[model samples]
Target chain A: MIDNTLNRRQFLKSSVGVAAVAVAPGILLYGMANGSSEGASAKVRWGMLIDTSHCAEGCNDCVTACNKENGLSGGVAATDSQWIRKIEIKEIAGGRQLSLPMMCQHCENPPCVDVCPTTASFKRADGIVLVDKHRCIGCRYCMMACPYKARSFVHEALHDQNPDVPRGKGTVESCTMCVHRVDQGLQPACADACANKAILFGNLNDPDSEIAKKIRTVASVQVRADLRLNPGVRYQGL
Target chain B: MYIHSAVLFRNRLFYALVALAGIVVLAGLYSVHLMEEHGHIITGMNNQIVWGIPHVFAIFLIVAASGVLNVSSIGSVFNKHAYKARAPLAGLLSIAMLGGGLTVLMLDLGRPDRLLVAATNFNPTSVFAWNIVLYSGMFGAVAVYLWTMMEGRMKPWSKPAGFFVFIWRFILTTGTGVIFSFLVARQAYGTAILPPMFIVISFAWGLAVFHIVQSAIYAWTNKVLDDYVQKRMKNLLGVFVIAALYFVVAYHLTNLYFARQSDFERFILSDGGIYPMLLWAGYVLIGNVLPLALIYLPGFGKSYHVNLASVLIILGGFSLLYVFIIGGQAFPLSIFPGFEVKSTFGDGAISLYYPSAPEILLGLGGVAVAFLITAVGIRMLDFVPHEDTKKFH
Candidate 1:
């Protein structure tokens, strides 16, 4: 008798090892697919460079596009959700006029994130500041702390929300930098809508990206740079 | 031997007061329901002016609540015999007022139902997070402090409890001031002096509240508060009110000196419509100056005049908060320096705010809740002291 017990134990160990080896590759591939968006790495910091000089005085293409894309064209006047808006600024001394779209700067050191009690206002690994609506108590302390005044409180009940951009009543919201498009490897709506090539969007950290190349060639200014928030959004010819 | 104090539940006056408070609280609850159902659009607050009258009331109650405990702290911690008798009432008022303030703050949330989120998921860096812990901690500390004072066997524990409370209240008020002080965005609030300033104002406001309640209790029980006790407390209040004014002046002067902050200073001191009037006439003249003169003046040392000063101080407290909370927001954020900017959003313009009825009701409801708690507490326990001149001396 050739020790039947020994033979059975060896058979069981060999079978278990073979099963794991066969199944492991499939599980690893699934995990990789879920983790990477078409192999887009999080090492790339997304940013925007706007040439205000190229921007037209009255053209609201970017604003309208953002509204349409974000489902904010509703009649919530005085309490309207304005994710991005064109601001007209004139120098008091020189009578020089400048127009630029203002939105969340997507700061590396966001004061809104700092003041939020529930950590509802948070920055993603990729540097996009977002409000977690489920967690926000809507105390508006973040609004007070934000130097740019980029955030808005949802003042009324919202219906007919865009399936792509989810929003609701009793929560604070602001520009998500069209994060859905970004995840899918596409430009933001505002950048896509710019007829005069005023808005440029791309990966800031990538040395070969168009935005980084342009920023290297020309001077760009971040609004309220004195605060040293290290804004992802930069303006040319302000 | 100790003389046991009697509870005051049988008075018809007590019943009437409790009933009135109950109605106010109900009204406040109804308003919260309406705001929750219809949304914040029903209120005067817009996106620009986020915090409104509710904040003014809430902050005042919170600061005053901390200050109210000073009497007990002085008695128990510092060994002042005169204040020992008053310690129990002081502890009661502090807890009640703090509860009232927290209630308003909770009801004002966009999703009051999600209070669990705030309690559980906290940002350690945020002053508000610290406040939640401080405020919740305060209730437990103050309740035990009150217990230590009330029970004969627990008398030995009172001093340590009072010491803990004194230190805690200081930190609590400091955190409250830090909520604004830490804001780098606001030109009006960036200062190290804010915490100390809040402490002084808390003292004045808290003492004023204590005086009003004390007088009412004495009147109700057909007893007299010793003249020496009245004189000492009122005189101390006068000093605190003046110190508060001095801090206000120093704060403004500091702002006025900075070129970047000059416009904001101007807006608050002179040009801004309601702010200037409230700051000068309401807070400085009526609240501080007139009261200071009354307390220090010879003939005005009587209980009637002292009470009048106390009432004015309380009113002045409202004015000061109105200026601090609303006025701070009214002056627009300096988004772009040296540039005149205009947008669909109210930029380069002072955002308008008018307090609505629902907001007022909610604030009053907080006050009513505080008063109701105090009334119930005194009715059930020996919170009020049996003050005899001989015993105190």
Candidate 2:
């Protein structure tokens, strides 16, 4: 009797696992086909160039813009969901003090992507680190693995979600490079909102592009360059 | 038969509690929905302290749960027949811990709906991904072991599986340590203490959880937890507490001795105020010192005080984990050329955060689920023992 029960349990477990695999993909494909291809316009390898020289000390337009576009929360409280941040980097003693506009570095080798127990957080073929919200199990291992603290966890129920970049509680979120808007050939809300042009959006791979030219003609460094994530985003002295 | 049915009817209390937890979880699911739709606004977490109470609690519970299983596996694998009787319980507890821990994680997320994304598209590079695999394997083993035992299928092959679980548990704990260890930008870099720290946490949590559950069950059954068992567990906890304290002292001393930057870091233990409070109040007082006193004292030993100490130590160990993850994250390294740059996540700068009601309720639901699973297994299986009590015990 016990053996029969054990066999039945095993059979049940296997069948459930199999049935899940069989049915899940059909639903996922249907969803992704509806969503992942939302941007049918020119596919751009979105990158950032934070010009520390002109940042208005604490004008959080870029932060708020990303939040507004991506549907994030902002406040005086140190927010867990920082799609962007402005950090003051002083030059040692008496030189220039610069404020950095920090966002996801979107590394070529994102540590967060590296340590995920599941492939929920993955780098798209186009070098974008995207979380397949459908597959994310809320483990937050990616949050820990992310050196930049770039990821944020939704700790509570937030239903008034933005349609463009929809996110829910219990999953990790970061600057998506506006996967939604960028699909339509639109620039990120942060770059679009930066009146000072303190932020630049372009393709890092495009040598003919202004960002690539700036990197070539002048010198810029990525944050924590020593960590060797090869961050796509670059900063001009902060 | 009706009397037996009456006993089963009495279990309705447990069922009612489970149902109550389910309702709370359903309410919490609304909070998850809110977080999913709007963003993480229902809680106090901000950019400064993104990983808050739920993360710490989940991680701590998992390590403790892993340790509970380790105690049983260690004995079984190594021919320590003395511990063999406790193997089933340990196996059961491990599954419970994993379930409880994962549920905490699920609720803590900004998007619990996408949790499956982690598994379907596994990232080999992500430590979190590796943790998923490790947890899957660990839980899979324990669950299988438990199921087999319940079905009276325990065989020679079980020992090898137990041995595998025993070895990998240390690795899993060490890997958990490495998660904190690899943060070079953070002041916790170079402590080389994370692995041992988890080991201590695992022991404290495991023993505490063990005693807590056992004593509770024994209480319900109107049976006294044997004096010998209580004495042994208390002594074991006392020894671990001292060792954990020693590691804390040695770790801090070594840090301060090596790097002056750590002086500012030591503020966590000293000047950081609440961190120190958590240390002295949480880790030292509840986690180590009080438990030590309780174990040594004779009066408390006669009653459920040992069980009570277990609960306290479990809470204390949880607090220490908080100090480690949250407090550790809070202390910014004084790496700026001249002065200490405060951590975005630290005290004063710490964005006030706690587990949202939904988060806690979801955690409770996870516990209920685990208990319900265990109850069902116990009802249908010989692992709960059929007739002969002394044979397995």
Clashes of each: 0, 59
Cα lDDT tens digits for candidate 2, B1-393: 247876776688667856775675566566556656666666555544556766766787688778887557755686655456567877877787777777777666655565656557766665565677777788887876665544555665677777777877877787777777765556555356877877776876787787777666565455655555556667777777777778777767777776655654567778776778988899889887777778777666644666677778877877787777677656553323342233233322433346566555555555665565555554444332122235324
Which candidate number maximizes DockQ? 1
Tell me, by lDDT, which candidate is best: 1
> Which portions of model 2 miss their true places by more than 4 Å?
A1-49, A56-82, A117-120, A124-141, A151-171, A176-213, A216-219, B1-39, B147-155, B182-185, B188-192, B219-230, B250-264, B297-305, B331-348, B371-393
The interface root-mean-square deviations, each candidate in sequence, come to 1.0, 4.2
Per-model DockQ: 0.58, 0.25
Model 1: per-residue Cα lDDT over B213-297, one tens digit each: 9998887776788878887898888888988889989999999899999999899999999999998888988898888878888
- Candidate 1 chain A weakest lDDT stretch, 10 residues: A26-35
Q: List model 2 lDDT by residue over A1-238, tens digit each.
A: 4664354334334332333323442231112212232322112244778787778876778888887787666743454466776666556577566676766788888877766666667776556678776666666656655666677665555668887677765667787877676544456788889889978876654444577678887668887777788887888865
The CA lDDT at B251 in model 2 is 69
**Measured with DockQ on alpha carbons, how good is candidate 1?**
0.58
Q: Name the lDDT of candidate 1.
A: 0.86
